[model samples]
Target: MSHFPMDIIESLRSISRQTGLPIWLVGGTVRDWLLGRPAKDIDLIVPERAFEVGQHIADQLNGTYIPLFETVETARIVLRESKMIIDISNFRQKMLEADLFARDLTINAMALPLNGPFEPAQLIDPTNGHADLSRRQIRAVSKAALQADPVRILRAIRFTAMLGFHLEPQTQQWIAAEANRLIYPAMERITEEFFIILQHDKAHQYVDVMDKLGLVRVLLPECDRLRNIEQNNYHHTDVWAHTRLALAELEAILLSIDDLFPTHGEAVRHVLKQPMASTRCISDMLKFTMLLHDVGKATTQSKDADGIIHFYQHEKVGAHQSRAITKRFRLSNTETKFVQNVIRSHLRPLGLLAERDHLSRRAYHRYFRDTEKDGVVILLHALADISATRGKSNWQTRRQNLIDLIRQMLDYYYQPQPNPPLLNGTDLINAGVPPGAEIGRLLRQLAEEYAAGTITSREEALAFVKQAISPDATTTPHSDI
Candidate 1:
């Protein structure tokens, strides 16, 4: 067996001797240790009264006790000093053999004796889990195991991607046969598993495998609808295919972001690593956005008189659709807004690039302002989207142009503001402007003009406002304007 900290070993021995209960190190912890991976969490199985044992362990180690599930006599002890979690649970059945047999996968069914010497000879493998581990394959213990809990279907995919393992043929067939059983689990559980899958570096590969097994259709019907929705010649594949490729490209960009743009690498990494909501990182959220970026194309697909396909306002429609999806998954309000805003503005970078020469300072300010702190994220998504397509002429030049645009946005974001506001709402109210919505509109206009470099001083802003409110003014003072 692999060496563990002396303190952990001694603690386990003390707990086993004090309680006089049979405790065994079980499941993923043992599996990970045998594979030479650091085990952050330890799982211990007892014949009965697992909660009492968990409480004893918590008191012994002065760790925080978390009651995970009362029904199954399961609890968790978080050892802050070691940064390790000890999960205690009762056997699923009366016997240890039955409990091990009931596990989801063979590689996770092995256990080690915790009360005695921690050695490989002490392992209790009711199934050939060690051999399966040696072969780097995920084999289901039995079909009944998965039938008991369909969430293992997703877990299988996660392990395949994370550990670089392949599913056994029987296991794959069982997954396909029982894929629909996923609906029986709580949406939160499903969402958590899906989020974990997205956290992997090569999530797209496993996601494609999930799609082939019909899991995507059962989980996200919105994305399934994009499978055959054809796009214009600008795209080499259909909507769903392009979306998948974009997701893969997103991973590639993140992996090589530092090498691709050394100047803004730190800023890019910081933005992607920030937490959004429910402990989900911004990078995982971006992967979800990329998958659903073109979902609106399915509904808004139309052919003009000359047979030219058009998805006009798809981004706007996609934003609304993405909001509904996020709500269904019970994401926090902050997360919902982040996903919706990014989807809505996914096309803005390219739109700005089309008018690169005429992109005023005010336009730059508005782009970053509307995208919020996700301006860099939106630009990366746009880059992945463009890289996935084939029909764009001067593709190399366009890619370079996008890189240049990202640098400009990053400079604007990280560096000091070029034009500070010369007037605020208070300033406007004090300048004979009424305290109402009009003040806000006029202040925003002044700020825009200031960003455009047309007005530099408070007196110039006052003069510009004066010209706008005058009867001889040709332009109207609208909120958006």
Candidate 2:
């Protein structure tokens, strides 16, 4: 417990001294301490008056005391000073041992009393959790664990992904048996837990695990439909197999992203590491988006007179279709829009194959302007698709050509071009334009001109806007402060 602030522990010990009600630091707090990991939050169990002691400790630490559950009288103390959280609660059962036994996992069932010095010898491991920790396995405290709360099914896999631990034999059986109950939890909680697993280094392996455990059937039933759908000769496997291959290939590509795009290694890493909506990293979202990229194929699949299969405008169809799933998962609006945009534009890189050796400036302009530099991320996803498709004998040649095109695309995207418009609403309003959508349209037009090399100076921009707004008149640039 030396990892924790001494003052906070002291306050709890003082409370015990005065009230004479036994307080124990239980569950994850004790487990994390044993694992030598720092604690961000601790669970405390007291005989009674959880709110009173929680408020006192909050005041002692200058934190806020928020009452949680009125029946159990659970209260939370958020300490900004140490960036830690302390949750005080009355025992769920009559005693600490019963409360510990009632927990989800054995590793999280350990505890230590706050009345004395912190020592491993003081640990209350009623379930032999210490041995399981040594084994790096997650074992449920009882067979009724999953039945008590179906959400723990997701939590069990989450621990495996987070800690790189395996499930004990019986625990695995319980998970496989109770996997469908995962659909019963609140969608937001389920989404949050799924995002955590996607953040793992090799999430595809766990995706395979989820598939085998039958969780995928309940969580992503659409995938079952994709399994029966076959693909054209450009792909050797059916759509379902290719989808799994895509996820695995994408993970490999991301891990070696620096080597693949050596010159822009750090730039690509920075974009992927950025947090998207709900505070999930862009890298995590990429996996989800990639898996669903071809989902429209389920409905759009067709065959021509030659029996060659085709998925016409699947990108557009997929973007339109994925809305329901995105909404179901409770993704933030910003995240939803991003996923749809990627799905719509995923085929842009391949479409460039028919163009000349060097792409036009306007071609780059439209893609980057629409995506707003997020095209860098789209390029990575496109490369993964190309890598996963190995049906053609000349696949390497096609892949190389696409790689060259991407390098050129990224280079053009990163060039030191001047910031667009050279104008703003203030400048426009100072001139003759009103403060509304018209100003935005004119600015967008000016930005387009700047990108296309049609206008080079503020003087030219003023003339172009004046000519476009009123052909008979000329306007001057804004100068006075």
**Per-structure clash totals for the candidates:** 0, 0
Model 1 weakest 10-residue run by lDDT: 472-481
* Candidate 1 C-alpha lDDT tens digits along 188-285: 88888899999999999989999988899998899999988889988889999999999999999999889877887987898899988766999999
* Superposition TM-score, candidate 1 onto the true structure: 0.92
What is the alpha-carbon lDDT of model 1 when measured against the actual structure?
Answer: 0.85
**CA-RMSD of model 2:** 5.2
Clashing pairs in 2: none
TM per model? 0.92, 0.86
Candidate 2 wrongly placed segments (more than 4 Å): 1-7, 14-19, 59-62, 354-356, 419-481
Q: What is the lDDT of residue 319 in candidate 1?
A: 94
Model 1 ranges with Cα > 4 A deviation: 1-6, 17-20, 65-70, 418-420, 466-481
Candidate 2 lDDT, 11-41, residue by residue in tens: 7778776767678888888788888777778
